[model samples]
Target: MTELVPTPNNCVLPRIRADFATFNDAIDYAAKSEKGMNFHDMRGTLTRVYPYSEMRADAVQMAYRLVDAGIGKADRVALIAETGPDFAALFCACTLAGAWPVPLPLPTTFGGKDSYIDQLSVQLQSADPKVLIYPPEIAEMAAAAAERQGCEGVDWDTFAQRPAPEVELPKADPEDICYLQYSSGSTRFPQGVAVTHAALLHNLYGHAASMDIGNNDRVVSWLPWYHDMGLVGCFLSLIANQVSADYLKTEHFARRPLAWLDLISRNEGTTLSYSPTFGYDICARRISSQSNVEERFDLSRWRTAGNGADMIRPDVMQNFVNAFSAAGFKASAFTPSYGLAEATLAVTVMPPGEGISVELVEEERLSGTRRDLSRPARYRAIVNCGKPLPDMDVEIRGENGEVKSHHQIGKVWCRGPSVMHSYFRNQEATDECLVPSEDGKGAWLDTGDMGYVDAKGYLFIVGRAKDMIIINGKNHWPQDIEWAVEQLPGFNHGDIAAFAVETENGEEAPAVLVHCRVSDPDERVKLRDEIRDKVRAITGMNCVVELVPPRTLPRTSSGKLSRAKAKKLYLSGEIEPFRLAA
Candidate 1:
């Protein structure tokens, strides 16, 4: 019968500049502060208050244990990202021991046992980590994955309990590789993004400065630690910037999403929290109809509700404002950003207090197709993800490497100190994305995403070039097709995935796989036909539509629908859609 108190929102520590020589240096400074991390239960009640001082001590112990086990400098230690004190300590321990910590995603509910194991196995094979540590609950699957990769696997509890003799820990320089981050969708072909200590610190500095983080600012997050935004933006950034933060386990938030808001309500002066569009959509749908929005929450102090990790949905943002306005939530609190693991984290962050702003562009322009007079003009709302960080340079470059004018859509390219060192041991892939500069300033990263910057310098993202479906020499974005189907009745976000599939006549056509909630065979056929017609009307051509059961489509680790994986599974007959009557 012990009462748990969360960490204080404001600490007495003097706000230090994030100009550390290395990540370990950042941790050493943060350890002097009274601030720390707070953990919450499923119900949003406080469970643990971990001080930075204690965390440093625990990390040192963990580092000694790792060194005793012959895991030293430059070794790869893959850790299953479970939001808790243990994972936090071990992550810091890796940096302290001069080993690289590779944070991997936990088993998601969407993918069953075999799928999760396969994912881990592939990633392990790529990383070739010296050891894989995971929570005991997933030891069976973790061990299986490790065995497949021929590496040592141990539950974190058992590993932590091992004896540790005092040993010399290797020191890391600014140029040293601190960790490897795998992009959310990098499963079948995993490419670990190698980040240097200087790059990591630089990104954290830019992110903290972008938000104008004050001593009173604290973060409340439920984002998975495996993703870039969750790891660098929330976890590592806090330690570097000496900010106290609170957390709810990502899985627990999935089960009880409202708990995320409840913790925000409970924590006074909690100013910053981030998620993809789906997180806001879920919370809005969960509480929109309830008349007790004000009774259930107090969000007046929630200053920055950051949006990233996927396309920013303006409709979803408006819906969230409508749903939560009664609880003192301001529409201006939305802080949308654009970034990837390749940049370590925040390449561009929306200026605080600027809510979601979007531009309505012609659909044909977005798809890079000529508009036909016979068809009605359609428009897509492209969200403005904001300007680049202080050290970052943004450009829209054509295929020929010439930079395009403002408002002219092309590939998004960025260069900065925060850009990743390289793709781990994959020089070919590294060279493909990171094109070196003739002036030798640095390499510019081909973001693979298509976007344009406005005259005022704000970035507006179109879509991914790789996700485009080409048919008869015209380009079609899958988002447009999927959004067209989403307008039909009884549909939801992530319910449809659009990709190019080969037709019987050897022609390529857009194929939409929709989540069918209806169980009746007749109704299912009707639904498929409706979806097909809707897609055809938008794309001006016939499309193949298949009705699949709910949650049948695959999602990346960060919960974004994986169109590439969906197509692979569907073509391989792994995802058998509902049969339509012949």
Candidate 2:
């Protein structure tokens, strides 16, 4: 075997070396490369498809207008528009002006006008942006919220008219904060993860290197920009690499899953992307509905179908591959990855040209000794999240702070240039998350995820350490139990929460609670029985299934179910208990 070589400096710059001087040089290079590249969406689509010159001029003009609107260095500007050319331009403007852009998701409230107003109000207050830029439809909503908070609300039309300002770009330090990314808030209060320009640049270079992204690659993605994966993985990486890309609206993709594939096939896109579970389920559902999907388009150009953001399902991947094999979609295109918002975006990416690999381990053994990764009669598959990126190191340490041997589940810790500077405005939380070990040589960012590395040096994430439940000296992952219960027919699709609750003696046991839309009482009972039987059959542990009314399940601002909040409601009996499976 050949020895691994260091990446060439001309290929990518390190964070320390990527100062304002080098960053400007990179921007110049990108500008020169962007001549024929389209920046925005196509005609009739909500996307903007401008060439490099147009994108640069628009961004520069937007930067001037933003400064005139009192959004300068270090000021926060909240963007409430859907994904489009204007959103990208405004974001680039923020970066140019050294402003932090906080992108909030559009409010989703099926209740009524008041419900929508309330939700929007809460986000506006939380964001507290200096200026709120939104589309015409939500201009009034944004104006009212901004008025209530004493912030300025600028409609896109008025905001677009300002002439490009001639402000000198500041020399950005390596530690200068770039943007604030909020968590999904699925567990608790959403804290903004403060990423720096240096960290972002570093991570993007690593991402491009791992995915083999270049100026020639055309990326088409529909993931939400508010999320790190969409923002950094798709948008910023494209801009930094001077690559052309097409972005579809997240809503559009959700409504029509085939549009995602259609866009890729139509564009002959080399970089196919999405969160792992999403791409898998989307392909699965599409294949089930249409039989001739494989014959319709040529997916042979798809080089990298990236999978990240959530737990990777081996069955889902295999099913998708088998379903689309006739369509010229190579199984080798599936790239399982691991990353977090705290790491800017990517920490580890599976080796290039290599597809996903899974290790089938005994579930019981995992909970017991955390020893050998023995193949089980009923196995739990662990997909490789790949190796750490260049200049990054990953280690799994036990509670005692010592590095664990291969196959021992421990807290995943990362040390790299791409790690965020700190959590925004929360030093205490920062200290806790970014800490030094007992030996105190170097610092490591606590990923709070639990996983182990195999003998082949591949990382296999099992679950989150903080999400584990200790019941009767046994450790149980909510995902394990939740996956088992979710396999049931009624509980398979909707909002579900599985957590551990303590008895009067303080001993905890797995308590499964499911929230479904089914209204009929007899049907509810059958649903509960199905969930219980399936969970019991999968895992030997007997779980209690409680059925609640539709929409009772607490979701975060980003629409993820909050198991922590659900557990609180369950313990306090604040939730209305409907019927349970007999």
Query: What do the candidate models score in CA lDDT, each in turn?
Result: 0.88, 0.68
Record all residue pairs in model 1 with backbone atoms less than 3 Å apart, i.e. clashing.
Answer: none
Estimated TM-score per prediction?
0.83, 0.75
Maximum-lDDT candidate? 1
User: In model 1, which runs have C-alpha deviations exceeding 4 angstroms?
Assistant: 468-579
Write one digit per residue (lDDT tens) for candidate 2, span 300-400: 88878888877777777777877777777788888888888889888888876688898887765555434444743446788899988887889898876
Indicate the residue-level lDDT of 508 in model 1.
60
Give the per-residue lDDT digits (tens) of candidate 1, residues 238-262: 9999888999998898899999999
Candidate 2 lDDT at 116 equals 40
Global fold similarity of model 2 (TM-score): 0.75
Number of backbone collisions per candidate: 0, 5
What lDDT is reached at residue 240 by model 2?
Answer: 72
Clashing pairs in 2: 40-48, 40-49, 41-47, 41-48, 41-49
